[model samples]
Target: MKYTKDHEWLRVEGDLVVVGITEHAATALGDVVFVELPEVETMVAEGDEICVIESVKAASDILAPVDGEIVEINDKLVDNPGLVNTDPTGAAWFFKLRLDDLAVLDAFMDEDEYADMIG
Candidate 1:
């Protein structure tokens, strides 16, 4: 898994990259109450706001970490936004993206680097 400075985690599964906020981000957001996910098959550029998450504290947007097509989204989050807090790095994944080259992930931070940045 690779991490972004924005606190998003990217995990490669087969040829797709799964995207989610880190536990740190989830905690900062307080308890999540609603989620607005992007539609599958939508094309997005890096830095685009792809999803909206509303918590007890505030509403936050999940940005696309790379250029790709959104191939899938986790519908579970819509029904249970608290999943973002309880299972952020696992079942709370926001979406799966199919990028032109998975190699682009090399530019992101490793887990150790991410931990250090958070600290």
Candidate 2:
């Protein structure tokens, strides 16, 4: 798994990539109440604000890890926001992308480095 200092995780699956907030991030965000996802087929550049996750305390922009077109989004989050706080690494996955540049994946932090960053 690749990670970001901002507490997002990316894992490649075939030609697509799955993205979600890290456990630490979800915990910090508190009870999530809403999620805003980009429409499928939307083109996103690396570092683009592709989504927003709103918690009871604040709303956070979810950045893209690679330049890609959005292929899918987890619509489950729209109805069950607690999944973000309860299972951030699994059920709370926000979206998938058909990445254009795999090299951009190298810009993210590794798990250990990201853990340290969050601490």
Best by lDDT: 1
Task: Provide the TM-score for each candidate, comma-separated.
Answer: 0.99, 0.93
Model 2 segments more than 4 A misplaced: none
Summarize candidate 2's per-residue lDDT along 1-119 as a digit string, tens digits.
89976688999888888999999989889999999989999998878998999999999899987778898999999999999999999999999989766767887888888877877
**In model 1, what is the error at residue 84, expressed in angstroms?**
0.3
- Using TM-score as the measure, the top candidate is 1
Residue 4, candidate 1: C-alpha displacement in angstroms: 0.3
Per-model root-mean-square deviation over C-alphas: 0.4, 1.2
Q: Write down the lDDT that model 2 would get.
A: 0.89
Each prediction's whole-model lDDT (CA): 0.98, 0.89
Q: What TM-score does structure 2 among the candidates reach?
A: 0.93
